[model samples]
Target: MSAEKITAEKRTEFGKGAARRIRREHKIPAVVYGHGAEPLHVILPGHATMMALKNHGYNALLELSLDGETHLALTKQVQIDPIKRVIEHVDFVAVVRGEKVTVEVPIIVVGEAKPGTLVVTEASSIQLEAEATHVPEQIEVSVEGAVAGTLITAADLPLPQDVSLLVDPATLIVNVTEQVSAAALEADLEQAEVEAGIEKDAPETEAAADSE
Candidate 1:
């Protein structure tokens, strides 16, 4: 991953009041911690951080400059307000060169399955261990002309040399199945109703014979 350079200021104050003051000045409160080091609390430029995170996603590497000292950090977690959808707090974890980290990479399907086949994604993302710097933006799964009953498992996907799947080999990621029509759905519903009638009458008939 490429490091996105951003300027940060050390936060001296704490709590709601301090956070509000920082935000009012168009800044965001953030913390960076990793490698057993003490967590560094800092204020980041709201607009710049927002833009970088919006484009690069949660796994982005940010080159944070706090009081002229630069550090490489990963965007670990972001807390957002439920109603307003504004970021409340952010957590960054420091990463060293060649360090491996497990992350959920988004699954993307390329090309269309066979004409009559419907692609069912059993998993939206796959977990993998990759170098911090080489972490892929996303994993692409090709379904080009895949026919019905075709399955794409975790083991079927291609990975970079440094990346390894952490998910089970037997895990089903995608399945191409024949699409069903409305008539088929109606027929199944009718069959289910007939079976339900048989089940519902057996006990009633036995009770009537006992009464006779």
Candidate 2:
């Protein structure tokens, strides 16, 4: 992965009002801190930053140009509006080339399991320590021809060179089990409804009332 170049302007104002004003101007409030350096407050172009992050994953390495100086940083956190789903604020951490950083990489299941078997994923993502600039976008687990009772753990995952898993080796990632029949699933749902004291409506009773 390559670092995306984003121009940032130093921010002078602080507070909710200032942040709202910045957003109104189609910018996002951000702070950069790492390497024992003081936090730097800045504003980034909202559309450009969102597009860059969408192209790259959350851990995107960014080349931030501020005051004619460029610094390498990693996206640490992004705050978004829950209702509007708009980017609100972002936190970045300064990192140097070849530095290793621990981050969560999404898990992607590939291939189909054996007939009559169902693949269940226990973990959707895993933690890994990798070079800050070369963090993987996702990890893939193959279930091709996997039979029932087959299990995959973190240690069984194939990783790129220099990348190390930070999760427990025994952690279960995927489990292949016999597929449950539709009738069995329905029976389980009925049992759960009974345990919760939920009663199904009787169509005959409704018909009787209609006749009255």
RMSD per candidate (Å) reads 5.0, 3.5
What tens-digit string does per-residue lDDT give for candidate 1 at 59-103?
Answer: 878899877789888887998879978777899888887899878
Alpha carbon deviation, residue 136, candidate 2 (Å): 0.7
lDDT accuracy of residue 186 in candidate 2:
100
The model with the greatest lDDT is 2
lDDT of 2 by residue, 131-197 (tens): 9889988889999999999999999998988999998999999999999999999999999999999
In TM-score terms, which candidate is top?
1
- Candidate 2 has its poorest 10 consecutive residues by lDDT at 52-61
Q: Estimate each model's TM-score.
A: 0.87, 0.86
- Candidate 1: stretches off by over 4 Å: 198-212
Judged by lDDT against the true structure, how good is candidate 1?
0.88
Write down the worst ten-residue block by lDDT for model 1.
196-205
